[model samples]
Target: MKDTLKYMGVVVVFLLSLASCTKKWEDHFGSTSAQKTLYELISENSDFSTFTDLLNKSGYAESLKASKNYTLIIPTNEAMAAAKADYDFTDTAVVKSFVGYHIINSIYNVNTGVDTVKALNMRNKYVEFTHGEFDGVVPTQSNLIASNGIYHVVGQPLKPLQNIFNLLKSKFFSTKQVEAIASFDTVHLDGETITYHTSPIWISEVRRNMTTESRKYTYFVVDDESYEAEYAKLKPYYTTAYEEGNTTRPDSTTTFFTKKAVLRDFMVEGDLSPETLAAGVVSITGTAFQLDPADIISRTKTSNGAVYRVKHLTYKLSDQIKQIKVLGIDPRGYKQNDKRGNIFFRDKRDMNGALYQDIEIYDHKVTSFYAKYRALSMTVGKYKVYGRAIMGLAGDPQTAVFTQYVHFFDPSIVAVNEPDLYKRPVFNYLGNADTRMAFEVQPLNPNEVYLGEVTQDVYGNMQLLVMCNGTGPIILEYLRFVPIIQ
Candidate 1:
């Protein structure tokens, strides 16, 4: 009977040890068998009930519950009420977007010494945490630990900033510019049945890229009144051709093309503020425009880009000259088929012992080289022409006499009466002994050497002609025409 009692005492001790271990684990973890996840922790907190409801409405509750290593910025019930006034929680897409902006995929532990921290939210936009604030929304408590992630209670709900397209739609409704742009439609005849859709296809193109793409862009938008005011300045010039049914009118100056040009000119390729935009902004059409302090109406930061509402926008005369690489120019202009007339000539006997492709203007039969530019849309002003050329052939004599001409279709004058502008005695080189040498040609007299000061008559077609006097073959390299914008 004594032995049986001792065995029973041993069994009791083992049971007591197991019970002690279970109590210790329960005290440390503060849960039954499993720890609370980020979603559950936020759901259980009374202050964050509004945020919990948002997660459920947005269909992110299950995602958060299943996800690991995340940080949730939960707003209080009062904060959510304020946000509900502005945001439509009934719209599932909007709710999803708003929730995505508050949740981050990575775990972020708050550092006491750090003043601010930037984290990328699930929406791919940045959410800044600064001094107990997450992107201007004050957080009441932070670093609430959970099994799957951490949660921070914020005083205000977070909203994702709209992209450029949406910003224009929301803010400029009264302007009618946004409505006119988005509502345009085009009809297509695919065989017999007519098919119609939106017109000005660029609107959809810009919208798609701004909303979905990761690339950034800067857009300058104006109200309908401002657009009309700007269009009035260009209407007188454009309407004349339309009335005459002039099919040959340059597309760049047409009413439709001009609108596209103006819109594209306002948009820059990157995110830029008015201060940075003043430095210089190049449009898609290769024109340059500047932003003045008075032009800015407002600026908004967006997820994919920035939008700047401007009072007025205009294209300035670009002093920037376009460079056409000599290598890319075609030499023969359908008039002659001679080897000497070729602008791009490949010579194997070059001094470097390698094949060389250089522009060769042979004087054998008045050979000519041409450079074309599309800067006739520029403001009426004198533009200076400059040239770089190699003086002589490898084994030929140096120096060559050449004449330069500036040919353009002057819209102000009748086609047959348009006068030819040329620079007489373009080059009177006093032969050099140095062979195969390169030199830059400058205008000795502004009147005698330039391509000629352009006038308002000039439109789009502008051509530069360099003719040899059959003196010798000249090696032409490149030419530049800089506008003298006063």
Candidate 2:
């Protein structure tokens, strides 16, 4: 009995020593386990099986296995299954774009101690990490670290951000709306027909603001019903040059201008809250208007901004086409009675950040000298004529003040061509000469000097005459005709 007890004690000691030796061996070799790359971790996890398959299809799964530092965002199998409808995996380019948006080149983990970090992904798009979220997506499993970098498992896949133009195309498909938006492209017509989009007139409004992902905007788009309603509302004001000869009524430029007019003020800067929409008059233009909350059907968050699809959009004709401005440099009938070297076109930048091509007629010290501009698109309504006359050219100290009055005449009835103002070739004076219409031109830029109002009995293009009354240099920027909204 004593011999058996001693033998049992020896066996227990030997087993304990073997367990100790095994623990030490594991400690020495475990660094290889820590050397597992993010790709290795992701590929091994059953929850990320779908993501692994997508990464392999993207042809970039091998990149994640490299030694470079990165931050990968992986979605669960369920999340990937849900995202299948949103993407076309059949296209290689689409798969690559989707995968590239997820892998950031830099390392970012929760332990970095920052609540929000705006990191640039492999696709050069900004993916914002705010507390527990990534690009508006919250992580289901936060910050799992591996050898190459850290990864977060999200319930939803990160979608690449889309600018305003792409958002409009993807969300809305109305007929007139689509036609108007697409008309800005180059049209190959073999003739003397003039294309209105030769110069990008909407650089400030659409071209620069809408196409860039750097700037944020809230685009309000209407459905077909809403577009048709808005189009009909502005039909009376936006008339075509050649009528169908059916009615003296409005033929809205439904092909292009009308849709542009309707959607022009729809883009507002920054994301607006529901509170702002509830206040009404969202300040779409300078006019006070109202928006019914019930009219908004859906709102989608975009990469650059948000897109709100509404059922109704209110646009007042007066606000939409508030004024028709005839600039001196605008290629119209800027022709004078005499063609000489005295007429100089000067480009000046206004303090209001507007570019002005001013017309400065020098060496013409004679009174009654005038410059005629073809004022187009004048409807039959009273317009408050205003002129902005900058007296001096940019970088020139000659700020001489000049006095001028405008004369409106029908081009069909203009008597004759006068070579000179002092010595008449052949001419006739207009009748709407009021004292209030005269402008005392000064150096103040962007100030709209009101020059009385004119009532147009005919609805078509008319000739507007800017006649000089003083001897100083006649430096004028633009002539504007603002419709009396009432």
Listed in order, each prediction's TM-score against the native is: 0.57, 0.62
lDDT of 1 by residue, 1-486 (tens): 999999999999999999999997567468521377888777777987877887899877886887467898888898998888898888899889989888888888654434757688887777766655676666678776777777787778776887777777787756645653443332223434332443434554344555643567887777677777655554433332342222343233355433543455556677786678767678655667666768788888876668888876656434222322233134424224454443445443333343434455444544343333233333323445444444344453434444433344333343442123322222212233211112333322111122323333322334434444334344444444455545
Judge candidate 1 against the unseen true structure and give its global Cα lDDT, from 0 to 1: 0.57
Compared with the true structure, model 1 gives a TM-score of 0.57
Best candidate (score: TM-score):
2
Cα deviation at 156, candidate 2, in Å, is 3.7
lDDT of 2 by residue, 105-175 (tens): 88876433356577878876668787567877878777666777788888999988776777777667554
List of clashing residue pairs for candidate 2: none
As for model 2, its CA RMSD to the true structure in angstroms is: 14.6
Per-candidate Cα lDDT values, in order, are: 0.57, 0.68
Clashes of each: 2, 0
Q: What local lDDT score does residue 113 receive in model 1, on the 0 to 100 scale?
A: 38
Model 2 CA deviation exceeding 4 Å by range: 1-47, 62-70, 81-94, 105-126, 140-150, 159-212, 223-225, 242-254, 281-288, 324-382, 388-402, 407-449, 454-467, 475-480
